[model samples]
Target: MNDAIHSSKAPEPVGLYPHARRVGNLLFLSGVGPRQRGSRDIPGVTLNAQGEIVDYDIATQCRSVFDNVRNILEECGSSWERLVDVTVFLTNMKADFKTYNAIYADYFRDNQPARTTVEVLSLPTPIAIELKCIATID
Candidate 1:
């Protein structure tokens, strides 16, 4: 594995994992939450009963998550278009999938990277979504 890369513009990692790790030309990004910059805790407004944030009315949270992802990707000399695969984890699979896809479509408008989305029992803080991606740099 190549040295891990981090982004100051993104939220500080809450656990032992680095923000992202690069090996050769491939970057493996840890699952990213919707925590805003400089805040260790996720914004409490949009979450559901299962601790997953409600993504329906909140475009900002979605944007923040993508921004965090972009920051990490850029730190490793890549971008959203370079993403080859993504796995999205959500607390409520049924309600939020469409909204998530609508917002996500704005980001991956062109490349349409391979992706999988799963609804899990729970997450770190009941946040709405967590995303992990594999990307190629150059």
Candidate 2:
């Protein structure tokens, strides 16, 4: 029942915050972005060299966001199987929701977690997607 922080080898935290925090048996993860470690390059489904939305393509951004989430989960001594809930924030829901759901299904094939998706005017970056979750460490 102690409050502690956890990190994994998937990617380093952008700041002082740990990838997740554990209280009791539950772990709370921060919102995850699509920036891969050591490389400022953001994977794009359609955008060119510049960072742009590129006609609402979501697969690449969705996958990268999930990869970041997976990394954080692994570092926190958890996995997708232990996930209890997730909250997804998107800049454009009308165009990207279906694509995001399709890509998201690839990861949550089992132990489907409770989820909420919301449409937002913008995200931290121009990226189309971001995800945050809660999990249990077994």
- TM-score, every prediction: 0.85, 0.83
Q: Relative to the unseen true structure, what is the Cα RMSD of model 2?
A: 2.6
Top candidate, metric TM-score: 1
Q: Can you write out model 1's per-residue Cα lDDT over 49-133, one digit (the tens) per residue?
A: 6755554343555777888888888877899889999999877778778888899998889988899999998777657788999
Each candidate structure's count of clashing pairs: 5, 1
Task: Kindly list the per-residue Cα lDDT of model 2 for residues 1-138, writing each as its tens digit.
Answer: 756564544445556677777887899987787767766666664555666656545788788888888878887778878999999999888888888888888888877999999998987666778788899996
How does candidate 2 score on lDDT? 0.78
Off by over 4 Å in 2: 1-16, 45-56
lDDT of 2 at 121: 92
TM-score (C-alpha, index-matched) for candidate 1: 0.85
What Cα-based lDDT does every candidate model obtain? Answer: 0.79, 0.78
Candidate 1: C-alpha RMSD after superposition: 3.2
